[model samples]
Target chain A: MLEVSREMLAKGTRAGLKTTWELAKVVVPTAMLVAVFKASGLLGSITDFFAPYMGLFGLSGEAAVVLFSGYLVNLYAAAGSIMALSLAPKEIAILAVMLTFAHSLLVELPISRKAGSPLGYVLIVRMGCSLGAGLLLGVILS
Target chain B: MTVLWEGFLQGLQGVWTVARVVIPLMIILEIAQGNGLLQKLNRLLARPFRAIGLGEEGAFPVVVAMVFGLTFGSGVILNHVREGKVSPEETKVIGTFMALAHALIEDTIIFMSLGAPLLLLILPRVMVAYLMAYLVNRRNQHLSLPEGHHIQGIN
Candidate 1:
């Protein structure tokens, strides 16, 4: 019993540290970059351009960073951008819901292919689910 | 405050929020692993797996992917495929489900830190996975694989 408890503690601490470090590494830099964009007024124009489309999802244009980064990179990148922005809870929920349906496309697409599922089908399902769910959440949450 | 400073503070605050949630959650997950709770959960998944058209053989990798994440889940699927324990059609179903929703616990908490609704994350993802997998399986039921079709693109 004692040995089991000790092992659980050791495993937990190790996993916790690893997760924390990975999250911190991504969050810090992305947060800084977002700040820089805001200060330079770059974010404003970017937001303006995307506002119409993003508004469909009930998110600010700034949320494009989170969604696109999540698709092209990974969840950590998306999470970094998400954390940097000061969004309302509803906006965050919408973005989060969309991302859950689709994120890390480049990496995961091939995995699906290797698993013998057609890549095109995988893309359709992911992208379809993401946008469809996003639109739904936008309407319901907004 | 300068936007940069504000960004930094926000970053720190976000990190703090994530840390508070992630650290303890990770610990509990690890303990769950140690205590065999994850395996039990995997076993408990059989009913849902059946509802989604995945056989008993399909449940392990699906549960692994949900609990652990993509790479681990796919790796397990590949292993079982090689071992001849799971069929390609079933693997396709598993792959579809995993694509829709993997890494449930960790991903949920991370997003929750940013104030996303917890139910929105888990419930929809699960429903989508279940629906998609069942559809994929039903659609492909009549299609037979070519003889000796090895797992493709897995090198």
Candidate 2:
């Protein structure tokens, strides 16, 4: 019993370390990039352009970075952008749920195809569910 | 330079925040896996899974995905399909569920760090994935199940 617990602990620590390493690389650089964008006012213009549409989901236009980063890159990049931007808890919650459905689309989409699910079908379902949920959450929360 | 430094620090802080939650959860999950808790949990879930039309084979990947998220869970499900343990139809149904809700612990924890309420963050995906899977299972019988390699070839 003691040996079993020890093994679990060792295994867990290793797994955790691996995750930390992977996340740290993405989080730090993306967070830094977002900060630079915000400081340079680039994020502002971008936010203004997208605010109206993003507002439909109860998010500021700035929240688009998180969504885009999540979809195009991976979740850690999204997390970095989310932290870089200031948002209400409600907004964060909505984005979180949406990303949970559809983050890492670039990678996961292909993976889904390889797993024997029709590619287009899974893609539509994932993105459709994400956006639909985001809209619903936006309305309900507001 | 100042902005870069600030972003760097903030980024590291973000990593630290997530690390705190994820590290502990990973440890607990490892312990659970070691103790046969995952299998026991799977056994407990068998009836509920069937009610959702996932069947016994679907349950393992669902549980794996729920714990580890899509990337890990999808790999395991794919392997099962290769081994002929899970049919292509079952893989599709399972994949649909997993795509919506995998990595429950890690994803939820990270979002929680951003002040997302646990219920709010967790429920939407689970509910969406559930309904999606149920719908697919019901509708799948009418549709021609796509061959795995052909599906891959579409890319």
Q: Pick the candidate with the highest TM-score.
A: 2
Candidate lDDT scores, in order, read 0.83, 0.86
Clashes of 2: 1
Q: For residues A1-142, write the lDDT of model 1, one tens digit per residue.
A: 4134877777787888788887778777778888888788898898899989999999889888789878877777778788777777888888888888888899998987887678899899999999999898888878
Best by DockQ: 2
Task: State, as a TM-score between 0 and 1, how close model 2 is to the true structure.
Answer: 0.92
List of clashing residue pairs for candidate 2 = B69-B103
**Share of real interface contacts recovered by each model?**
0.65, 0.76
- The docking category that best describes candidate 1 is medium
What does the TM-score come to for chain B in model 1? 0.85
The parts of candidate 2 lying over 4 Å away from their true place are A1-4, B143-155
Interface RMSD of 2: 1.7
